[model samples]
Target: MRKMIHSKVVFSPEDLIVVAGISLQMAYKIIKELNHELEEINKKEKKNYIIFRAKIWRKFFRERYYDEKFLTINDLEKKFKIKEWEAKEIRSTIKKELVAKGFKFIKGRIPEKAVLEKIYDYSEEERKNENVSKIVKF
Candidate 1:
């Protein structure tokens, strides 16, 4: 007997293709439908974004052809090479930042693009600080 393994992470089109034994085109169609449903839910909840910012676009493109759509806590831990507690803290911090910026977060999963963006931004900031400190020392 083959034991089935279920993933907690959000499914992308490729995942659908593998799990559902569907063609790429079919998987895309399913993704389109799911996206539409998600939009409707957002609308019903009155969660409208006045601005379609760069961050949102980044998130879209990053997740577009990827295998993981939404990342679970475990995925976050693996991606950042952090402990479970650190993952939770990072997720919470990101959530707070997004909320402050007027974005509504879907519960249970983190946006991969957002996580990547945060890491990139942090590294840039650190580099800038290091440059400033070097100049001061010189």
Candidate 2:
């Protein structure tokens, strides 16, 4: 006699809620939104299943959350190529500057535009130093 074993691959909405740190209602709402998007794609491409894959959900979440205006610590580290402590220091410095300029600083997120501007200024300084070194060598 031969026995058959079946594997199930399921990602419940609750799992999405937990992973996304959103409410149960929000999880269902996001699922509905994803389903609608999938349906549109399926209709356009004539695909069979109008289902949401885990990979698709992750992409959607990242796109919705991590945009130019708002960035997490990981984004800062990757963009600035800095250690975690350095990233925190940069964030703190920027926040203080913004507060001094009458802007309110939010916790746990840094403004991407401000961080990018700082990075650009730092790069420009480095380029100037390199040019000065070349002139001194000559």
Candidate 3:
């Protein structure tokens, strides 16, 4: 069997409690919604089983929130063509920047809109060339 990178393929209620700072009751409700969505995927893929009432898929959770989207450190690393450590550092800087700008941010993830706008600045030229953005602090 292939080994997992993070030691977790699914998010348990306890994990949600810690990561999301939500109550256990809310966690269960989130899990239920995740399972329901999984059921839809099951139908499309013809999977035999899709019922996972106790957990939420981590990828799904990362791609979605309520109104805002996020980028995992891994995604940032790939998007910016940077190393993992650099991506992490940039994420930290960006997180602080966003919070100071009055936007809420979850720990260990970067807000997608802020990051893109910061790098691209609403210009295709910047998007084509990211080096001009000066992403590193020191």
TM-score of every candidate relative to the true structure: 0.41, 0.39, 0.44
C-alpha positional error of residue 79 in candidate 1 after TM-score superposition, expressed in Å:
2.0
The predicted structure with the larger TM-score, 1 or 3, is 3
TM-score leaderboard ranking: 3, 1, 2
Better structure of 1 and 2 per TM-score? 1
Candidate 1 matches the true fold with a TM-score of 0.41
What tens digits encode model 1's per-residue C-alpha lDDT throughout 1-138? 422423433445555544434566765665564466446757898865332211122233233332234566888888789899988887788778767765544456666666776767654467799999999999
lDDT of 3 at 41: 77
Lowest lDDT 10-mer window, candidate 3?
A: 1-10
Where is model 2 more than 4 Å wrong at Cα? Answer: 1-68, 122-138
lDDT (Cα, tens digit) per residue for candidate 3, span 49-124: 5466687776666544421345778888888998999888877877777567655455566667667776766644
- Candidate 1 CA-lDDT value: 0.57
Q: Please give, for residues 14-96, the per-residue lDDT of candidate 2 as tens digits.
A: 65444444466665766676667767878999976537543234444444433225556787888768899998888888777
Q: Pick the winner on TM-score between candidates 2 and 3.
A: 3
CA lDDT, candidate 1, residue 130: 97
lDDT per prediction?
0.57, 0.60, 0.66
